[model samples]
Target chain A: MYVDVILNQPASRDYRVYIDQLETLHFDTKVLIVTNTTVASLHLETLQKKIEAKELYSVILPDGEQYKNMQSLNLILNACFEHRLDRKSLLIAFGGGVIGDMTGFAASIYQRGIDFIQIPTTLLSQVDASVGGKTGINNSYGKNLIGSFWQPRAVYCESVFLKTLPKREFSAGVAEMIKMAVTFDKAFFEWLETHDLEDEAHLKEAIAKSIAIKARVVALDETEQGIRAVLNYGHTFAHVIENQTHYTTFLHGEAVAIGMVMANILAQKLTFLNADEALRIVTLLEHYDLPTHYRIENVEAFYDAFFLDKKSEHAVIKFILAQGIGGYEISRNIPKEVVLEALKEANA
Target chain B: MYVDVILNQPASRDYRVYIDQLETLHFDTKVLIVTNTTVASLHLETLQKKIEAKELYSVILPDGEQYKNMQSLNLILNACFEHRLDRKSLLIAFGGGVIGDMTGFAASIYQRGIDFIQIPTTLLSQVDASVGGKTGINNSYGKNLIGSFWQPRAVYCESVFLKTLPKREFSAGVAEMIKMAVTFDKAFFEWLETHDLEDEAHLKEAIAKSIAIKARVVALDETEQGIRAVLNYGHTFAHVIENQTHYTTFLHGEAVAIGMVMANILAQKLTFLNADEALRIVTLLEHYDLPTHYRIENVEAFYDAFFLDKKSEHAVIKFILAQGIGGYEISRNIPKEVVLEALKEANA
Candidate 1:
């Protein structure tokens, strides 16, 4: 199955996201496969055999989120220079979000942009990161603080690659899938409640459904100016959670899962989501063993951190709240006391 | 006077290039003016006084092409973060090509791209670099080997900024203007022969004319997929010249001036230009005291260097040769011996 990401952009920038469809790819240009040590060790040969290029090279980066820095970015770029990859050359991102983001960022700036393909190995990346063109390395200030909205040439997602995924990591990917379902598709949310993703056939359908929703949202607002922000249903809170825990305690999707529950609390305050509706979402996340709670040590400190988020402009925090199921509200000017109340509730 | 660069891109990407027009500007968001030491010492205050923002900051990098690297780019990006500049904030590139390229590149990646204005200080920048959305920093491999096609929101070109420009630099700027005329406008080329740019009014007219030509060419081919390569009429030879001299002997425009002469020799070989037409170009370049000749040390080495240029793809050098004045040709498969003979003649 495949989802066409029809971005309301130049036809050149629009691409498709294929689910469980990894075909024999061929290119007449220099091709660089950028993967991490973990993915390289497990699945590099599988990916390598599928691609035939005039020149093929792979750069193995150390696996982990912490390695997603300028040093790694330079490693990818230096590899391009060393291999003499030109503007027409291509890059294949063959790992999780870290590899995809770094490879996409490298392609965006290499010779003022080049074509890059995303072969997402992790479910987290396949469902979310690989679909969006948000590519950048982190700085001392924050995550994805520096990046470009450079879309990929195409994205290939294969379920076979996920056979080796750790159980926790697999659940983390479900968090993003759940985030998509809760915000945009109550039917998808209901589908998740009834179906078991552990079954490969059911998992493929969910991935396609989630990517289709994401593609539609991205098409509406490629730069996250409007409806695209709605896709960040849990990210506003998730960013703060990740930063507070130094990104070591929780996977990004796991934080988003907890973030969704926290956002549901705020939605209850705003009457966007009823208690029963919020409970259903939490029950589904827990079914997948996804974390749906967090301890906020200092509500004030967390509140301050929202102002530092890239989405929060000029001290105005845009909260993405679930308006019951399959609906959302972007609350830009919610009173501080009301948010503090929700934070207190989430803390409890 | 102003020339609107109507890029066939999204409406948000199209911008205007204002010549001899630097007006008071205001922004509701934080603004950072990126300049260099030399430009800051002379005109930072001039530029700063004309802009009012909620918060204003300036980062003065060391001046020169050598400083146009990752370090300077980092300095600008770090300042944006330090000032807490958000997505809505703006950057003003206030210097020559080096500052403009670095600043524009920083804006392109900072927070996944933001709005920036160009206030070009040098004649070379005002007429050329400031108008193009090409933003990048040089690396160990080559000049502008890494960058994005990020157009600025607007460009303000004030001849007043040129008051402090050295005479040699001014002539170098003229080399680019001459290049624009020779490739796109025969009438403009003829007018350039009779007119004296040393006169302020004539210089302003020439600047506007050159920019208008650039604006038209850019509008047609924003990504240099086709006709835009014509703008690099002299650059094919110039890159080699710059590389050979380690970029210390001549300004970029000066090197381009010599490169134009070398290209003309090749063009004459192809019967693209008569001997008189070629001499006219050389005479105009010499009239401004721009370097019209560079003795090639090794014809074979210089020919090999062309392949290293980013424009060269798959070891195929695409030479942008003048097809007499006001016309150009993008020759993809020029025979080796013919080009070698031209190089040998230029060697003399």
Candidate 2:
């Protein structure tokens, strides 16, 4: 039987994460589980127990963003073909956002189209990547510049896996949560200000809220035609940081945390957000031990990379700026000088 | 500006191929022409003159079905990334079916995705692969078991390319047209029996009709959910032949020609198609000098290969059978003994 988990915007439901029981889904087809070392070591057993298929296998890829390249993607696809998984087979993306993107991409290409499910373990993934069907791998040029807006059949966000997540990794997930609250829901942001997310109940509620907001945004604009770019509130500068460091130094959400501060500074200068309000947001980020700034080795190179972003067009950078906390606007053709000034102020 | 070509089903309008001036469509972004050695040598200069882009370059991959594997697919994708071709950069698939599939797949996965257009040169591709958005490369396990249903931004079908195609290759293309007619349009099948494809105008009309039918079928069921399976009328058996022959012995259309005969025999035995009608289809195939049978090394092994097909459900084999000349049905769980009998008869 098929189950539809639709709840407002970012719906949250308690999902079971087990292994070797995939047969219970009543699908008599091949099941390909795409994952990396980190999740494979931590939760592969449980996932395997939940997937008891007639022909079940795992594509264990290299861990980390560095390995999230075309070479690794090809390796995963090769594994899919080697296993003879047909179009009816289900591909389970059993890892973080990287694994989800790569496996989703594999499923998207395998026989031109096939079914895939998202089993997001990381908090960041559970709240964001697992919901929308945007799948892709990174390139030397940029992240997610070459990808598809392919959605998954289902998503299983098992909070059970997050228990093993390191404090820093868990906080990285919170950075994205904060992004959702700040841009989409002022009420949610106010709740976060008073609530202690370290508490289990509060954290779960926060995840549900974040996912609900993201889901609503995605459902309304699956292809990022309009409101979806608001979802990239901090991604503009974050992508530059990730690119500058070659995706090695900072976690994605950590970089995004710094990016949010940069965006806030820009918003303040544009009179979109008050300086005191922006400072409060930064102070809250520090409360979670998130970074608020990053050093750029080459400003010109960093600035140039924005044009190469998937969201950019004809040298026009699509920047999602806040009109104020809990409100955002997607602006195109923001002058290079304006961006440069923001960059300077962010560094200052 | 973007152009969308919709080939109208069953009409000659879709068949009459036209070569529009490529220079007229201008893009500031880089334009990448992906092709093989054979096609490049013959038409690269002509194609280059047509493409007036700010930045233009070509990546000539090794030609032939043998090279249509993951290694080559990655080579094409890596080349695009290495060149720093971002999302705006357009990939032009400038060759036959292999080039189209591999190039489209490469573009689909680069950074998540980039736009691609098809310029099919082979008769087989013009009537078949070029119309559908299915793009992928072969793998160690099977042919086209890995790929995505990525539609091209536009498709340019210049019938002028057919003048250079080998006679055997031209016959190979006829195989798919026959499959389309016999399974979906009986009138078209009768027309093929009485007409010779040597007539360029008539051949173009048949191609256009077949492609229009394919495009409509694919558009309705882009993900192969239902009626789309009809497109695989001969592919079920053709895949086994290609796998057994290591994809070196026969052009894809040639193998498909032999496959249609097998499907016809099966349809006759099941009383879905009359024996006399099957003979008429075989007679038309003979006129084109296409293969109607094959020498099987091992029937069991050949049957085993069907399970490896992308259409199969787990280990279950699926067959597209005709109910009379133009009627079709998708059936699975057919007795293995019956399939083996068909394979033996195909060899006989």
Candidate 3:
């Protein structure tokens, strides 16, 4: 399946993502494949043999979310400079979320922006990160505090790469799909509930559906000023969870799994979602062996941390609640008592 | 003297640059003014008195081009985070080029990009830097190696701020105007030759003409992939000079002054510019008390430095040369001997 991610950004018309084999993306411009050490060791030679470019170079970065920093970003950039990849050159992000984010960011900044493709090897990036054009590095203060909404020229998703993907990370990727389905497509959510994603055909359809939903939302609101916030579904809580755990404790999608349960509890408290409907979402997450609960260390501390959230404003927190399936309601200033109640329900 | 800079970038629509007094923009969005210590100490209170925003906050950064880095950029981001600035929040670049660049970069990355306004306080920024959407911070590798092309919401170019600008800095700004005139508008170049920029009215006109020309080119090519390369008339040589001198020996425009002269020499050697026309541009630069020559320490080393330039590719330096005024030509692979001859001519 070829998914066309059409972003009306300057000079970027549109690009297609081939959700199968990595086709020959023939380019006259110089090409640099920015991948992690693990991906490079596993798949670099194969990619080099397949991709036809004037010059193909590989920049191997250290594997893991922790290595996604300014220091690691420079490694990719220095390679571009060394390779003399001009403004017209292309950068191929050939790993997971961390690699895609860093490579996209490097392309956005290099010579004040260039073209880059997303060859998302991990399921998390293919379904979410690689499609949205949200690219940046995490600072000491938070995750993705500094990034740009730079879309990729194309994205190639080959499930073969997921064969070696860690069990925890693969499960984490499913959480994001469940996120999209629950918030935007009731039929898709139902399909996921009945379907075994472990089956190759089921997994590919889920990935394609998730990307299409994401592509539509981003097209409508690329900057996330309005309806796009709906796509965040559980991201507000996920950011907090990621922060509280120092980002080392959970893969982003893993945090999202727990975040969805917390959001569902909040939805029930706000009377936006019935208890039974919310429970269905929780059961789906657990079926995949994903965590569906997290205990707040301190209620007051957890509540106070909301202000520090990237979405919070002037002491008012903006919440994205699922309005049953295939719908979302954005509420500003959900009463402190309601939030506290939701936190109580969230307590493991 | 109200000049409108219309850009056709993704979400960046048309923005006005008030060369007159700072108007009350009356933004309902939260406004965070990003300025330097010097500019803030001089005019923060005055700006506070003039501008009316819903919630006005200021982030005062350290002063100097040397401080324009990711660390300084973080200072702005940290302030945004501390203030809990949301998606609609606007950042004001409230100083010269350094402030505008870093502030614009911060806004571009904050929440994956937000809106920013440029309030250029220095003559250099008013004429050149403020109009373009080019924003970034300097890194260990080089100046502006890490940045994004994020345009501002608007620009307020009040010459009143330049009253406090130092003499050397003021002259440097004149060099940028001379740069614009020499490359794109011959009529403006002729007007500049006869007029005295020291006189306030003439200076204002020169500034306006420079901005209009810049705005026109930028509108056509927000990304410098084609005719926009002509705008880099002297920038290639200037970067090499700035690098060799450790960026401390000369102001940006001062180096540009010398760079333009070097480019003219190369153009004359290629017979692209008549001797008299090239000399006229050189003479006009000198009239503004800008440098007309530089001594090459080592021609081979200076030529080698060209490859490191962001504009260079495949070891073939793309030289933007003067093609009599109002016209310029981009030549790739200009013979090394022709470059060597130009360097020897540059050596005083």
Candidate 4:
């Protein structure tokens, strides 16, 4: 199954996202595969055998979110230079979100942009990160603080690679999948409550459904000027949580899982979501063993961090809140006291 | 006078290039003016007084082509983060091509891209670099080896800034203007041969004419897929010249002047340009005291450096040669021995 991401603004920027499809990929130009040491150890040979290029090279970075910094970005670029990969060269992001984000960014700025494709190994990246064109790296200030809206030529997601994923990482992927359902698709939310993603067929369906919803949102706002901001349903809070934890404690999706719960408390306070609906979202996250709470060490510091998020314009923090199931509201005028109260509650 | 660059493919990318028109400008968001030590000392206050913003800051880098690297790019990004400049905040490229390229590149990646305006201080920048959306920095591999095609919100070119420009630098800017005329506008080339740009009125006309030609060619091919390559007529040889001399022996425009002479020699060999026409170009470059010749130490090493250029694809070097005044040709299949002979002749 595949979903076509149609960006009408620049018709040429449109591409397709294929699910469970990994076949012989042929390229007439030099190709560079950017992966992490972890993914390289497990699946590099598997991916290498499937690609045919005039020249092939691999840049294996250290695994983990902490490694997604300017250093890793440079590593990918240096490899491109070392191999003399020109404007027509191709880069394959052959790992999870970290590898994909850094690789896409490297491609975006390498010779003022080049072609790249995504072969997402983890479930989190396959369903969410790999689909959107938001490519960037983390810095001392925040996550994805520096990047470009560079879309990939194509994306290939195969379940076979997930067989080697750790259980915690697999659960982290489910968090992003649930984020999609709770914010945009109530039917999918209910389906997740009943279906066991442990089953291969159900997992594939969820991936396709989540990607379809994401594709629709990205198509509407390629630059996140409007409807696309809603895709950050849990990410606003998640960024602070990830920062406080130094990106080592939680997987990106795990932070989002906790963040969603925190956002629900704020949504309830804003009267956008009810108690029962909020509880339902929390219960579904628990079903996948995803973290649903984070203790905020300092509420004031956390609140101040929100202002630094790229979403905040001037001093206004635009919060993407769930307006019950399958709907959302972007509130830029949320009072500080109201947000502080929710943060206090989440701290428990 | 102003030339509106209409990029119909993505209407939002369209902007205007204003010549001799730096008036009071206003912005509601935080603004950062990126310049260099020399520009800041000469005209920073002049530019700062003409802009009003909610908050204003400046990042002054060292002035030189050697400083146009990743380190300078990082300094700009660091400042944006330090100032907590959000997505809506604006950046102003307030110096020559080095500052403009680094600033535009910094803005392109800061928060996944932001709006930037060019206020070029140098003649080389005002007439050429500042008008185009090409933003990047140089690396060990080559010049502008990393960057993005990020257009500025607008461009403001003021002749007042040129009051401080050294005579040699002014001649360098004329090299680019001559290049524009030789490739796209024969009438403009003939007029330039007769007009003395030392006169203010003549200089303004030439700036507007060069920008108009550039804006038209850019509108046709924004990404350099076709006719846009013609703009790099002298760059194929210039990049190697700069690289060979470690970017210290000559200014970029000065190198381009010499490169144009070298390209003309090759063009004459290919019969794309007559000997008389080639001599006319060399005379015009010399008219402004621009360097019209360079000693080639090793033809083989210089020839090998062309492959490192981003313009070359898959070991094929695409040479942008002058067909005659006002016409150009992109030749990819020129037997290299013919090029070697031209290099040997230009060696004199």
Instruction: Give the per-residue lDDT digits (tens) of candidate 4, residues A1-348.
Output: 999999866677899999987789999999999999999999999889999999999999999878989999999999999998988899999999989999999999999999999999999999999987999998877778999999999999899999999999999999989998988999999999999999999999999999999999988888887998888889889989887887789988999999899999999998999999999999989988998988888999999988766557757788899999998999888889999999998887
True contacts kept of each: 0.80, 0.76, 0.82, 0.89
Local lDDT at B88 for model 4? 89
Chain B TM-score by candidate, in order shown: 0.98, 0.90, 0.96, 0.97
Worst 10 residues of 3 chain A by lDDT: A5-14
TM-score, one value per model: 0.98, 0.88, 0.91, 0.96
Better of 2 and 3 by DockQ: 3
Model 1: share of true interface contacts reproduced: 0.80
Please report the candidate that would top TM-score against the real structure: 1
DockQ of 1: 0.77
True-contact fraction in model 2 equals: 0.76
Across A1-348, the per-residue lDDT of candidate 3 in tens digits comes to 977777656445577777895766699989999998899888888888878999889989999888888789889988987887777899999999999999999999887888998888888988998888889887666667677878888888999888888889899999999999988999999999999999999999999999999998888888776888887888888888888998888888989998888988898888889988998998999998998877789978888887776655566787888999777889897889988888987894
lDDT of 2 by residue, A58-125 (tens): 98898887787778878877777677766668888888999998888777776777778888878899
The candidates' DockQ values read: 0.77, 0.46, 0.60, 0.74
Off by over 4 Å in 1: none
The clash number for model 3 is 0
TM-score of chain B of 4: 0.97
Q: In order, how many clashes per candidate? A: 1, 36, 0, 0
Score candidate 4 by TM-score against the native.
Answer: 0.96
